[model samples]
Target: MLEQLLIFTRGGLILWTCKELGNALKGSPIDTLIRSCLLEERSGAASYNYDAPGASYTLKWTFHNELGLVFVAVYQRILHLLYVDDLLALVRREFSEIYDPKRTVYNDFDETFRQLRMEAEARAEELKKSKQMVKPVNNSKKQGQAQKAGFDKGNKKREGSSAAGATKKGWFSSMFQSIAGKANLEKGDLEPALKALKDRLMTKNVAEEIAEKLCESVAASLEGKKLASFTRVSSTVQAAMEEALVRILTPRRSIDILRDVHAAKEQRKPYVVVFVGVNGVGKSTNLAKVAYWLLQHNVSVMMAACDTFRSGAVEQLRTHARRLHIPIFEKGYEKDPAIVAKEAIQEATRNGSDVVLVDTAGRMQDNEPLMRALSKLIYLNNPDLVLFVGEALVGNDAVDQLSKFNQKLADLSTSSTPRLIDGILLTKFDTIDDKVGAALSMVYISGAPVMFVGCGQSYTDLKKLNVKSIVKTLLK
Candidate 1:
């Protein structure tokens, strides 16, 4: 059963609720759905989840942009509610027909919702039965053999192609180059070139999914536009892709930490930056690097050793603090990292430190217990910046890590407005050379800008992301 459905305005006015859910949803998940996802331009996500003290809810939402109405459905976590999508669509359609912008109450929608729910459920049942009757095909061995046969033939022809393919080289590029006159571009005209561009991006370490999306976006932009004469379709496509990459890499929000730090210092509060990421991504080391960057600007910094679950995490941070000649805060291992971070922030304030770098344990995104702890620390401390430390060497896993981090933080937060990752710090930048596609993937996934990149093993290895140069290298 659907736990509840909500209809509201974009301005946060509730027009209708399926039931008086009361304090069961004490933290106000709808408000969170707005803050964490919709406000952050992540409404493209399939669904949102909120965990309460005694219950967990999965939320799916839809919007009528012209009508300025938001429709949401909430259900229990355990139920495989396949009909939620249908139900949301049904409500959106029926309600849009009768919606009044001047009205604030929608008491009459209850009956319409009841009938819509039953129809959606019936349609869902039919789909479920139809799906169960289908059987799996045992095509793996046949496919494997066919693949091997094709590979053998390709290898045999490789010698001949190497000798003659020199002239066949740029065969695709030649088609674009041979186009003499200006004409309106069609999808068919761009297909081969965009396919090559997409493949080129994949070879350069861009995630296949992101590469496909980027190419599709470029196609949409270039489709039907008048082409200038003598413009190679390939070069035009490349130029469009280049522009797209630069837009994606450019920071949407203010990522100027130095300015924010001074503003926080004027308020006499330490600018807290929480470093979080999965295992061995160098959270502590990069946290120290950020501290070093601040120190060079004459900002007093304090290190918060909140990686209490990991052995030697505190010692490692302590060593960095000693080398940097800054104060270090720790409560040893097996302590609540949230409290440790809280105390560390207070210590920074007491000592008049300009910034507090909170080093958290590197944890896999699916680790719920640890993720809850991380959420608690963010809620408890309300850090000025939550920088997710990711490796530039990653490929598709980069999106997975960044998306899961944002999702887990939104799902596990104790506050109605949970803090998502504000910025990203791409480590191991020197290792990735021109395969700089992970930066694009991470930024695209989280919609957070790449603020700092760690290029070497020293304290001064940190640098801000250069959008033009990275885009140039990506399209090179």
Candidate 2:
């Protein structure tokens, strides 16, 4: 359903649900209401009432004066938060913790957040003041020229000071905290947040180790600075940490290209690819997309619905097959996956298909029986490529999963002597942000060439892996 309107106001969080807007307003604070306007033309009462999540309305509060309140919201609360002042307040609060006698990752992240908030507020103020100043009446032409000059000056100021300061703070503080695992202050967040961080960093990658060391250095630096500046810097550091996380989780790149197929490659032929990952990580959707890509490129493609364990897996694959107008070899959900895979391979071979993509049951990497099932499929059909489709947003657990699966697959391949696996297919690249050092490190550690990346859930969102393009997109 479409939202009729977005109302903004300043007050406590309150909401009312009634059949009509007027009815909702009767019990509300009249002074706080900005205005009441008809959102849509309705004949009678609304008849249906829905209470939206988050605050009932957003408000333009005094950001700096109520900095602590805003920080509490931005740091720990919800909603699609977007406000210049709130960001600045967060930065200030978090930065203070960073420069305190104790420093920690929590503190570092908060500090960096503060710096960005400050930058945004400073820029916003410049624009606001510049637009409102009085102008001469007689010379309209001169006024235009004068305004342009003022804008240029403001732009220069932003470029020279505030912007640079924020960027510098973000970069340095993130780098420092990434190195320091421990600091003077302690983290008091939920265990899951900490566990998520620990799981991500446990792989002993270069970035993770460096981040641990950086935090320690920042903690040591707090010894000499004044309380105010220390607190401020700490906030900047905290903001940087959050930004780093954003960068890591968001995918800035797409994998969309196909490698040139040679006859030799085909002789070693029957290009079998397997997709594996946890549920809702775009596994089945990714398989469909791959099928579409292959058919588009004029390669004879067959999809094997070996994901017999999942209830909707076969039907979902069948849906894509119908959409693409391609052939699919699938057993119903109750059948053994190995049987499905074996039959699919035989069918593909009989049809002279160039590519046979198998969609497997989803599982966490540590599921031993699942791993055994995968091994059995590999032995029976001997897929040329085993692309583990992992969610980029999973943070550190993803790396551990990769490590476990890669090791298991390697061992199975050595013993069974089927066609060696080719590479990985990283799904959900769009969710990863620009500074995805952690995810990149995970890929590097996996030691598999990431062949494809999924930009979105749709069929056309899949892209051929290009490292340069990936880096550029994320940074953007």
Candidate 3:
């Protein structure tokens, strides 16, 4: 199935994207491929086609010289390269009609790109039906093979009588055996079942080690167990898998900001929460979403635009606050974020705000100075909770970010007690479709439960994580 289509400039800026596979292509996989192809093209390499390492989907890309653009398509199953070429041609034609590179910005053409996506989807359906109609028949070969087995009329008559007698006996025997086997569920059977489940998890993007561990937990729970009379093996295994995931997902799952704010109000202190993550992972927007969520609960909230490093960081948060009708605390650009954060909390206390949500500048994990600054801010404020906001579409990159952030922050804490990210706020979760490996991977890697998921642009889009629903989707 055609999963996603992305169009980007040669400079690695995404112009437009249509997601059919349910997950948005937000992070490293697309970035790495675009960077590599652009580098190869710059080096005079002819190849433009590339496959994502360990990805379940196939990626095909082509470039347009005049626009300096790249068109890439992702599919769950392989299709002819020529089909991708045809789709790209259609996309280019539609885009060219609406977009003038010299005058129109790419962001303004989202509606045009969306219409092109609808057309592509309709064409894909037609191609699928045509392929099915032209599928080669194999029934004749099967019949010939049966004839070659040499069953003459007399032999058939004799075999038919024997088979009829055997069938009656076999039915009774099979029923009895099935009943007996219900009480004899063994390790040998569990191993194969567990292996199948582990493979399924990996196909959905769960890390191999995490999948194996999950399977092991399932096996331990199921080994030497007795199946109920009406219960099937698959059903029993699936239940065990669900239970295991629920256990992993349930720890530290509470995200009742309103309750916490009320309690903090009783103490005359603002319930402080600091948001942290890498660049372009929707930290600012997500902070705004959280603010909106609090407002819905009838709690007064204030925002701290402590992300003073980026040129428009303060402005972005300011825009969200203004729209939400919430007050903001900011020290403008180039100021120390740690000082801004401290001042914001002080302002929140003075204003009698119930909660202060501090927005910090996004920094790469390997950027030591920025990482230290983040650690310093956390230490200085000692906030009620530090939440790591990450994109669910980035797969394991989200895991790496949380793991490193947790580790670095723990190391920098001066108190004998270790401090880690209390929970995760997974953004773009609604776009992930069936590939939910990032959620499992992040929890397994960082041992932090997901507090909230960002599903859309509205404040109401931020929702609490549902363990049962998530496990069902993953297993499905």
Candidate 4:
């Protein structure tokens, strides 16, 4: 039987996955295997199979050469190999109907996947029933005997029906009565509700551990609280969950960049804000957006193109600065970023600019030399606030990046106040659907609140994080 299906792009990004109810493939092992398959170059076959402890794994994939997409279906049970091709065709047809690679973000296709899963399961069920009906029956005498036995069983069942109905009715009545009579919330009563919430969070790409923790916190808060009535149970549980999420999101709410810039102007110095993150996370664009925001508030802003390593990085910042009509400081390619940053601050001060936004090279958190250089820039320049720019689609990977960056900076700093990430700026927020787990995981892991969310390509798209909006999104 078809147990599960997973679709992945060539980059090994999980586009969507569906599993039979109550049968979730262990995520880590499957992820590891899929990553291996994606990285493997020797295989030219369209299909592959592997044997594992609980289930047999089969991979059937179709590649869209022009789009560079690899559509993979993972079947757990042994079935005819021909069906795999049919399944892939179905997926490809459905994907083409709803998704446009250039226009639509892939993360928002959960509902489409749900519909596909429903159709696939229905087809599988029909196949199974057809197979069962094809089995031949025994002789007429044996059939007559089976019929007589079935009649006897049915008569006995009817005779016992009243007793069984009474028992079931009493049990259900007691359960509802207990729920309505102010009984303290128990694990049995809360498990189903919390599981649903946890599942919802997981579907949003939140890490399992984080989702479990959030649900646990909500469950703990609701535990031992007397339920006013069965009718009110859902609302009461939702309230508890909302309160828990708000608590996580509410800390460090005030960003107030304009106020800070004005204060710095009074002190005759430019306030510095540095943007840091891995490659292609919209650091330069977001910095420009911030500059536009500051410029709107009448704060003079200058940008420092400190990203000296990556080719064309400086020019990218310069382009954004030009488009925004803001001054930019660049020392050209291969120049020391720290020196550029320091000189930029000096220039901003000399120009009477209220704020300087320094753009740094994006390097992986594990890249030691680059990380050390980043720490040096932070220590040498001592920016007022160091913000980590993260991609919303990366989920827990963003958390890992922030944690390592904070740790690296803390290790490099000799000052009593280590240079920790002051806040996070999550880019591509609008590209994601409801899976706001990156926000929760980033804050919870790094202890840095989200300061701003970059929702769109426009300058006006940057908005401060709203607690109610975030909580509502999570619950929704």
Candidate 5:
């Protein structure tokens, strides 16, 4: 079956073993059949096409002494490439359910799996022990062992807790004491104390190098400087150090970000939320999603279908409002969106609504006249949050839009008409793999805190943005 297959590319000679396969298949039963297959270039690579009249076939393969293996099956001349490369990651991912253990070459595969299972088990056990060695608590264990204890929820309150004035003071007091002692120690003769501690630690069987390193670390701490762990100080700490350095160098202004969001919220006497984005970027959909989320959160919401310039946009918002059983304020295509937004805010104020999200016109942030229109809306009925929504699929384009909008916000200011970007909302998050990275990079580099992320078009897809959460998800 393997001998019947051919490997051909545009400019390279077939491997020695592939040539041997051709020779071995020359007189075989399928030799004449294999010769009929044709080659074509696709995606800068060559593919083999085998066209037969009425053949239904299945293919399976194994490699005992090579870097790669492939198994192709042709059914009525429709071919399926089953596996590739030494890793066989595709086979391990797909078609894993159908790989039979009873086949000829697959018997060896079973042996290989067994070996892998044993190695995995051994590694897991080693990991368990290493985890046990750590000082940190693992919450998953049902019971605790001595010296490796977890949080004891059962014993949270002791039978006789403590005397009235007893127990160590607050964290600040203890920390102050520690700091004072360290300060005094820094002023004292260090060589003798270091030698004494080193001798004691070594006597307790600590390695000489480890003791010396620990002493140096302790000295740094005594001098009121943060001590670096030996692991962090190691020469092989490139990846971790680089990440730490980046974080240190690229500090975020969480306080300022929060303050701006709060200021925007406070500045609006009539609390309004305006969704801004370009056309075909899910701006209206995201506004509806936000409304749905607010409704789910038990906040009284009214959506303003103010995208009068776009056909069917009002209907789209109205449809979502009906499905969600939330009220909507909308006008037909000819009305101005700014007027709609103003009316919506007035209606929300009269109804004592918690939130009123206004879906504005579909225009690029770079459009100056459109931005002027947005500025007019803000001036007339100041919004609590001016969320700049953008597509995650646009990557760097999203960054450009954010920058332009932020700049406009900065430029469009009178004493009464102050505008600053409160937050950013990123949409189509689930469809893009690197969206989190791109979005975080946008926020980090542009100094904008992402407020919400739209993982899906559904109402429940709106998630409050946590920078740490985004980072963790992206790394994963």
Candidate 6:
């Protein structure tokens, strides 16, 4: 059943509600939606899931940008609600026609909503039936496509070689040959260049989806622009693509760890940072690297062996602690990680440590039990930063991992304002060479900056992300 529906202004003023004030939402689901999704520029996601003590919620929101209104629907997450989106659209249309900023209550619109919900549900049922009827045909088509795919797989290398050789004249040069110094650029004119760029990005290990979107963005920015005298289309396209790549790799927010550490020192509290990622991505190794970096600045650091699930996790951090001449807090394996982290922070505070680096067990994003435990630790401790330690060699899995990690953090959080990944630590950077598209893909997907890259096995091997160098390598 749908729990609630709310209509409000972007300014945080409640205009209407489907449920009575007596039965208003207990947990701030709307607040969570705005904080974890909208404010993070994740409005493009289809739905957001929130959890409360008794029930979980799936939220769908639609914005009436022209009128500065937000329409949100909240329902039990256990049920698959297909008509929620249609209902939202219908309500937006019908309500906006009657919406007025001066009026706060919408008593007369209840009748319209009753009729709209019925229409939306009816449409969903009819669409579901039609899809079921066509399921067999779709299955047959999929089988045919699968066979064609296998055949194509055998000839892929040949086709790729032919395409690569076909670009001997260069994609942009081919266009220049056709256009012969055209004054204005057009979308169709950039097709060859875009295709070449996509292939180039894919070769560098960029996800196909990210490559496609980057090409589209570059095409849009270059389309309808006037060209200069003797300017080759190749040069123009290269410059635009370079600029786009650099923009994507650039950090949008402040990633100054040292500054934040000093700020925490002033407040007499430890600057807590939690390192997390999948199995064998080097969370413990990178956590030590980060501890070394902080120690270099004369910051007293403590390691929290919150990775209690792994076999050698605590001993690993203790070894790092011994080498780094820092203290470590560990209760051994099978202990609650949240409790361990909490106790570690308390010890750090008592020992006058400037920073607390929490190393958690490596886990696949799809592991629900581990994910929930990770979320609990984060929610309980509220670290100053959550650095996702991902490998630089990851390709398309980079996007999937980061997105699901953030999703799980949001969905499993105990509070309205959930703590999400604030930064990234890219391990095995020296091994990747020119294939630096993983950084771009991770940053683009999570909107979190790559704060440090691990270049060696040594503790002092951490270094800052070189955005310009990466852009040059990608273009090269």
lDDT (Cα atoms) of all candidates against the true structure: 0.85, 0.54, 0.77, 0.77, 0.54, 0.85
Cα deviation of 27, candidate 6, in Å:
19
294-384 per-residue lDDT for model 1 (tens digits)? 8999999999999999999999999999999999999999999999999999888888989999999999999999999999999988998
Cα-based lDDT at residue 391, candidate 4 = 96
lDDT of 3 at 432: 84
Question: Any runs in candidate 6 off by more than 4 Å, and if so which?
Answer: 1-181
lDDT of 6 by residue, 261-288 (tens): 9999999999999999999999998898
Q: How much lDDT does candidate 5 score?
A: 0.54
Model 6 C-alpha lDDT versus the unseen true structure? 0.85
Off by over 4 Å in 3: 1-177, 182-184
- What ordering of candidates by TM-score runs from best to worst? 1, 6, 4, 3, 5, 2
Q: Which one wins by lDDT: 1 or 3?
A: 1
Candidate 3 per-residue lDDT, tens place, 400-474, comes to 888988888777767666678988999999898888888888987776788999999777899888888888877
Q: Candidate 4, residues 209-302: lDDT per residue as tens digits? A: 7777777656644655567755555677677777767766776346777787778889999999999999999999999888888888888889
1-476: candidate 5 lDDT, tens digit per residue: 22232221212222212222243322222222222221100111123333233343432222211112233322222443222222233333232443443432332344444343355446656766887895977885655564344345435445236432245455664466444432222314345655665565444333454345444533432332222332212221222222422342233444342344334446543447788877788887888787776666556678888788878888888888888888888878878677988888788767766678888887887787777777777777777677788887777677677777777755765434367666778888778753444564455434456777888756788877665554444333
Instruction: Supply candidate 3's per-residue lDDT for 475.
Output: 87
Q: Please, what is the TM-score per model? A: 0.65, 0.46, 0.62, 0.62, 0.46, 0.65
RMSD of 1: 11.4
lDDT, model 1: 0.85
